[model samples]
Target chain A: MKNYVLNNLPERTEKPRPFGVTMAMDKGLSVREVEDLMSIASGYIDVMKLGWATSYVTPNLEAKLAAYREAGVPTYFGGTLFEAFIIRNQFDDYRRVLDKYKMTYAEVSDGSIELDHDKKCEYIRLLSEQVTVLSEVGSKDAEKIIPPYKWIKLMNDELQAGAWKVIGEAREGGNVGLFRSSGEVREGLVEEILTQVPFEKIIWEAPQKSQQVFFIKLLGANVNLGNIAPHEVIPLETIRLGLRGDTFNHFLNQSK
Target chain B: MKNYVLNNLPERTEKPRPFGVTMAMDKGLSVREVEDLMSIASGYIDVMKLGWATSYVTPNLEAKLAAYREAGVPTYFGGTLFEAFIIRNQFDDYRRVLDKYKMTYAEVSDGSIELDHDKKCEYIRLLSEQVTVLSEVGSKDAEKIIPPYKWIKLMNDELQAGAWKVIGEAREGGNVGLFRSSGEVREGLVEEILTQVPFEKIIWEAPQKSQQVFFIKLLGANVNLGNIAPHEVIPLETIRLGLRGDTFNHFLNQSK
Candidate 1:
C-alpha cells in the first residue's frame, strides 16, 4: 500500500513506530462505535486508553478489548483504573483481570490519589516482570503539582523499575496538567525535565491541535504524543508530515 | 418511553418541533460514522447540512443520505453547495439529485459567490415552491464583509421570498460571519439584525461553546441554533438547559 498517508513528507512507519504514536482515549465509545472508528482510522492509532474509569461503567470489557486487539491496536485501561484497584488493595486482582483480558500493557499513576515514592517504585517493579508499564507524571486536578525536579526523579525511578514510557498528563482538554489555563505549555518545566529524561521514552499527552503542533515543533516531527481525540488522528498525521497549514508553514520557516 | 434527552429541561419535542431545533453540519463524516453518531445523538438533531462543497467530494452520498433519512434527520447540502450549483447554472440538476435523495431542505446562500439582490431573491422564490428553503446571510471568507444593514436587508428579503429559516452563517469555527476573527459576536450587528428579523424564524449557526452560550444568554434558552457538531449536541443541550457550568450560574442568577 503506497503508505496510507499522502506524500511521505516526514515519512513515519506503521505500528511499532518509535515516534509519532497517536494514543486515542476512549471515554465513552461503545464496542460497535470503536470498531467503526478503528476500522477507518486504526492505521493512525498506536494505543487506545479506555479513558479514566469509563471502561468499568461499560457492560462488556472483554469484547471492547478484543475489538482493538483484533485490529492490531494495543489496548489498556486508564491509570485511574489502576489507581482505583491499588487504593482498594486489589493489586493482585488487577493483574489477574489484565491477564484474563490478555492486556500486555499497564498504566501506573498517582494522579487522583497519593502514593509514596517507595511504594510507587515497588508497584512498578512488581508489574514490570509481567507487562509493559506506562508510568505517569502529574495529577488530575490543579490541587496537586509535582515539582519539575520531583517529577523528573519519579520518572527516572519508574523507568529504572522498568516502565516502557512515562506519560506527561495533559488530561482531555490539555489544560489542567503541564499546560497553563490558556493551554500554553510550560516551556521551562519541559526543558528542566527533558534534561533529566530522554524525550523518546516519554509520551506527552497533547489533546489539542495547538499542543500537538507545539510538541512537534519543539521536539521534532517524531515526538511521541498521546491523548489524541478520534477525529483528530488523520489531521494530526497531516500536521506531522507538514500536510496541514500550521506545520506546513512551520517547516517552511525552518528551511530558511 | 422516557424522553430521549434526560431531564428534558427547556423540553423540546422530537421533530416537527416548533422551537429548540438543533441543526448539525455534516462536514463530510463517513456513512458509518454518521450512523453511529446519530444512533447515540440524533434525538437532539433535526436538520443536517452536508457543509459547503464537502458533499461533492464524499464518495458514498446515497448510503450517507439513507442513513440520515432512516434516523429521521432531514439532510440538505449546504448553501455553499447551492451557491456552487447556481454559479455553474446547474440548479436543475442539483434539484433533481436532491429529490433523488428525498431531501426536503434547500439551503440558498451567496456565501462564496456573488448574486445580485434581485437574482438572490429570485433563486429563493424558485427553490421555496419545491423545498423548505433555509436561506443564509453573510460571506464565507473574511475579506467579503457584508455590512450589518445589508445582512439584515438580505435576511428580510429571503424570509419574505418564503424561507423557512434565515441562518446567520457562523461556519464551522463560529467565526467570520456575524462574528469577528476572535470568535466574539459582533453585538452591534446582532442588535441591528434582531431588530429586523424574527428570532424564531432565524437559525444562528453557533458552532463554538462560547458562541452557543452567548446566543443562549442573549436570546433566551430556546433560540433555534444550527451547525452544531454531533458530539456537541448533548453539550449544547446541557448549556441550553443550564445543566453545564457556563449557563448554570447565569440561570441561577436570573432566578434570584
Candidate 2:
C-alpha cells in the first residue's frame, strides 16, 4: 500500500471513484480467503460480487459478509441469484436477505430468465429507492445475441429507471454478450453501444486478461471493469496504471 | 470440512496422497495472504510452486516458505528461476538457498533454457541427492512443440534420473505441452505418453477447468494435477470428488 507500487505508474483514482472502478468476483471464497484477498488487494477493489448461486451454497456466508463489511468493501450477491429468486417468485425474500446483510448494492439481471424489459426496470426502480442498482443487460447463453440497437435502448431505459450502472454481461468466461465464443470483442456492437451509452454509467464485465487489455486500450486506463478474479485484482490495477506490459505505454504521456 | 460436502461425492484420497496430488502455484502471495490461504485450504494442497521469478522480487519470501513448510506442503522454486540461475552458473547458489529455506523439493527444468538432455538429467541426479526433484520437460514457447515420442523419452529419463515426479508442462495458461493452444488436450499424445511413462510418476499442469476435467476423466480421479491457481484448489478437489456437475457421473457409481 506504501511505495511498493512504482513511482512512474499512472495516478489511479482513490476510493469512491466514479471511473477507475474494479469490482472483484467472489466465487464462494471462505471468510479466511476473503480476509486474505482484502489484506493484499483491497485498495484496488471497489466492489465485490458473490458469483452466481455460490452464496446460497457457501458456508459461513455471514462471516464472509462481516469480513468485507469490516474492510469497508461493498458486497453484493450476483445477478444469477436474482434470476433464481425471480423464477421461484421469491423477490420479497431476496430483498429481505439483502436487508438482513445490510448490503448497499444489489444487481438486478435477467441473464438466465425472461422478464419483460419494463418489469425489470420496475424492479430496478423499486430497488434503487433503497440499495444502489447495478442492472445487467444481456444473456449468459451464447445462443442469445441481442441486437446492437436493443442493447443501446435497454441501457438507456435502465439508466433512466435509476440504475447506477448498466453492466454489459460478458459472464465470468468473457464469452457472451459483448464478446464472441473465442473471447474476442465484437467491434461493431461495442462501438455502437459505447456511442449511445455514457461510458461512466456502464460497467464492462471483462474477466479475461486480453479482454481487460482490449477495454483499457479502447477506453484508456480509467474505464470501469468488473467480474475480475480475486488474485487478478493487483494484476488488473497494474494494467490500469500502465505498469504492466500490456498498457506500459498508454499512460506515459506527461503532457496531459 | 465436515459433511458440508455431499454424501455421493467421490471418496477423496486423503493426506499423504500419492495419485491425487494437487500442487498450488503461488505467484508471490504476501505472508499474511499465504497464512490466510493455508488456514483455509492447506488440507487440500500437497505441494506449492513459488511461480517464475516471483521469489526474487517478493517481500517476506522466507515467511511465505515457513507457512508452506508448517502446512505439510513442500515448496519449490519455479522452472524459470532454475533456468535463470542455470544460465548464470548459479546452480550451487540455488541449492544453497534451497538448503537455507529447508526446501525438501527442487524443480530441475529446461523449459526456459536449452540445457542438453544429458546435463538436465545430471542436474536431476545431483539435486535428487539433496531434495526430491519434480523435473519439468517441455518448452514454454508456443512455437516449439515437443514431439510425443520425445515427451515420453524425456519424461522417462527425468524419472530414471531420480525425479520423484515428471511434470508434463502445460504452463499456467493450459495451452502448451500436452495441450493445444485452445487449451484442449492433445489426446493421442497423452495416450501415447501414458503407454511409455508410469502414470503415478507424472504430474500434469492443468490450469483450466476443462483441462482439469479432461485429465480427471482420462486418468481417473486421483491424477496428480499442478500449476493450479491458488483459489481453484478447492474447486479442483471438488471436481476430483465429483461434487461439481462436470464429473458428477464419472465418479458416482451408484444406480440411484
Candidate 3:
C-alpha cells in the first residue's frame, strides 16, 4: 500500500536489525490465525512467544509453529512453560520438546516458580548451547517487588550465562514486574537498570500501548518490545514511526 | 474436537438462537484474519460489528465482509458510522453503503454524536425497513451519565421504533455506557432497566470479562452480549458454558 501521510516521520529499522524488535504474544491462536497474522505482520514482528502455558492447551501446536517458521518469524515457548518443566523435574524433557518443535529460540523465566539465581543462570547456559535463550527477570507476582539493583544484577548474570537478551517481565496484562498494578511503569527502577544494561540487549514486555509509547520515547524507535498483541503490530509500528497521534509530535521535528 | 471437560457446564443456546447472542467487534481485521477468526469462532459469534468508523479507513472492506458472509455470520457497520452519516446529512448515502456491502444488519447508535432522541428513533425506524437495526442507547462521554429511567425509556422507544435489539453502549473499552470508568457494571442502572426493558431484547456491550460474568450471572447463560473482541469469542463461549474458571462454579450445580 502507498503511504497515506508521508511527512516528517521517524525511520524504523528493517528486519534482522538488532534494535526495534517486536515480539508478539500468542495466547492460543489457531494455525490459520497465525498464518493470517504472519501474512500481515511478519515484517514488524521479530519473534513470537506462545504466552504462558497456552502451548500446552493450544491444539495444532506444530502447524502454528510451521506458519511462523514459513513467515521467517522465530517462535518460542513462553518462559512460564520452561518454569513448568523445571518445577516438574522435566528440564531435559523441555529441551527435547524444543528440539521436537524445531524451535530456534527459548525463554528462561522464573516468574511462576522460585529458583536459585545461580540455577536460573545454569539453565540459561544450557538452553543457549542448544538455541538462542531469552531469560526473563522479575516476578509475575505483583506483591514481590525486586529492587532495581537486583534487576540489573539478574539481567547481567543471565547475559553472562549465555542469554542473547534479558526480558523484563510485565506479564501479558502489563500489570506485574516492570509495572505496578495500575499498569504504571516503575520509572526509577527502569532508569536504574538502564544505567548498567544496554537498552538494545533487553526486550521489555510492554503489552499496553501506553507502555510501548513510553519505551519508544525513552529508547527511541529502535527499542526492543515484546508481548505485543497480534492485531496491534501495525498500530505499534505506526507509533514507532510517529505516524500515530500519540508520538506524532515527538518525531515531527527530526528530519526523515 | 472433543471438549477437554464437558460435565457440569451450563447449556448454551445454539447458533441462530436469539437469547444468547454474542456480537464481536472488528476494529480492523484483514480478510484472511476474518476468515481465520470465523473458522474457529463462527459458532460462538452471533454477529460482527466493524467498530466505530474503522470501515472508512480499513483496507479491503468488501473482501473482509465476504469472509464473514462465507462463515454465515451477519456483519454490520458500527453506530458511529451511522451517526457520521446522519451528521453530514448523508443518511441516504449510508443506506446505499449498507446495500453496496450487502450487509444484513446495521447498528444505529448515538454514542459519539448528540442526536435528538426522537430523531434517533426516526432514523432507527427508517433503517429498520432496510436492515435489521441494532440501536444503541447510551452516550460515549463518561461524564454524560444517563439515569436508569432515561435508559429504560430510550431502550423502549428504540425497540418500539423497530429496532431488532437495543444495545447498551459501552464503546469498545467497556468503560462508558452501562459501566463506570473502572469497567464496573452500573448495577442499579442495569437492574432498573431490566425491570422495564426485557433483557432478551437488549445487547449489553460488555468488552470486559468481569462485565460478561456479571451479565451471565444476572441473566443466566442466554443473555445477549456485544462489543466482544474477536479473539475473545471462544473465551466468552467458555465463560457462558462455565467451561472457564470465572463462571465454572456458577454453572457447576446447574443440570446438564
Candidate 4:
C-alpha cells in the first residue's frame, strides 16, 4: 500500500528524528500484531519497547528482534527487565543475552528497584559506547514519589553520563508519574523539570489523549511522546500535525 | 499455539460469544490496519464499529468489510453514520448501502442530531426487524446536554421498539456522555436509567480505562462494555475477570 496522508497535516521527518518521535510501548503484543504495527505505523513509530518484562515471556525473541531490526526501528526490553536482571545479579548475563539477540537499545530505569547513582552512571557510560541507552526517571508506584527537583537532577546526571534520552515514566497508564490521577500534567512539577533539562533530550510518556494534547500544547508539537497505545499512533500523529480537532482548534485559538 | 491464560488469568470465552462480548471502535483505521487488528485480536473481538463516518474516508471498505466478515466478526458503522443519513434524509439509501456491503448490524442514534421520542422509537422499530440494531443515547458534544429523564425514556422505548441493545454514548473518549469529564459514571443518571431498563440490554460505552473499571465495579464483571479501543480488549478482559492488579486487589479487599 502507498503512503496515505490522513489530512492536510504536516509531514513528520523520517527516521533519525530529533523531535516528533513516537515510542510505542508494547505490552505483550503478539508477533503478528507487532508485524502489522511495523508495516502500518512504522512511519510514525521511532522505537518499540517490549514493555515491562514481556520479552522474557515470549520464546524465540530472536525472530521478533530480527523483525524490528529489519524494519530499521530499534527495539529494547523495558527498564523493569533490567531491574529484574540486576536484582538477580545477572546484569552481565542479561547484556550477553541481549547481544546474542542483536538488540541495540537499553532502557535503564530504577522505577521498581534501586540502583546506586554511581552504578547507574557506570551502566549508562558502558552501554552508551555500545548502544543507545534511554535512562528513565520517576518511580513506578504513586507513593514512591520523586520530587521535581530530584527528577531534573537525575535526568541531567544520566544524560551527562552518556544516556541518549531521559524518559519521564508514566507507565502504560498516564497517572503514575508526572501526571496527576486525573491525567493532567502537574504543571509545577513539569515546569520545574523543564527548567533544568533540555526539552529535546526528554521523552514524556503521555499515554492518554488529554495528556498528549497537554504536552503538545505546552511543549510544542515536536515534544517526544512515549508509551502511546498501538491503536492511538495515528491519532497522536494527527494531533501533533494539527489534523485533529483538539490541537487544530487549540493552535487556532492560540494564534487568534 | 494453544491459548495460555493471560498473566496466569483464567480463559475467556472465544469469539461467537453469546455473552462476554467485546466490540472494538475504529475511528479511522486503514484497511491494512483493520486487517492487522483482526489478525492479532480477532479472538477477543466480536463486533467492530467503523467509528463515525470513518468508513467514508477509508478506501476499499468492501474488501475490509469482507475481511472482518470472514474473520467471523461482524462490522457495523457507528450510530453517527445513521444520524448522518437521518440528517441527509437518506435513511433508506443508508440501509441499502449497508446491505450492499453485507453489514449485518446497524446503529440507530441521535448523538449529533435531535430526534423526538416518537420518531426515535419509530426508527428503532424500522431498523430492529431488518438487522441487529443497537440504539444509542446521550450527546457527543459537551454543550449538548441530555436530561436523565429523557435518556431513560428513550432507552426503554428503543428496547420496546425491538432494539437488541441500548448503548449509552461516550464517544471515543468516554467523558462527554453518561460520564463526567473525569470519566466517572454519572451515578444519578445511571440509577434513573436502570429503573426503566434491563441492565443486560444496555451496552455502556466506557472507552477510558478508569471508566471500564468503574462500570465493572458498579455493574459487575459481566457488564457489557462498548467503544473499547482495540488494543485495550485483553486488558479490559483481565479487569473484568479480576486478574489485573486493580480488580484483583478490589476482590481481595472485599473478601477480607
Top candidate (lDDT)? 3
Backbone clash tally (model 4): 0
Candidate 3 global lDDT: 0.85
lDDT of 3 by residue, A173-213 (tens): 89989999989999999999999999999999999999999
lDDT of 4: 0.79
- Against the native complex, each candidate's DockQ, computed on alpha carbons, is 0.07, 0.08, 0.08, 0.08
Give the TM-score ranking, best first: 4, 2, 1, 3
Runs of candidate 2 with Cα error greater than 4 angstroms are A1-24, A28-47, A52-62, A71-168, A182-256, B2-11, B52-60, B80-95, B112-126, B141-144, B172-175, B180-185, B208-222, B231-256
Model 2, B209: alpha-carbon shift in Å?
Answer: 5.4
Cα RMSDs of all predictions?
Answer: 7.9, 7.4, 7.6, 8.4
Q: What would the per-residue lDDT of candidate 2 be over residues A120-208, giving only the tens digit for each residue?
A: 99999999988999999998778998999999999999999999999999988898889999999998998899999988888999999
Top-scoring candidate (TM-score): 4
Task: Tell me the fnat of candidate 3.
Answer: 0.07
Better of 1 and 4 by DockQ: 4
Q: Poorest 10 consecutive residues of model 4 chain A by lDDT? A: A1-10
How well does candidate 1 score on lDDT at residue B205?
88
Question: Could you estimate the TM-score for every candidate?
Answer: 0.63, 0.63, 0.62, 0.64
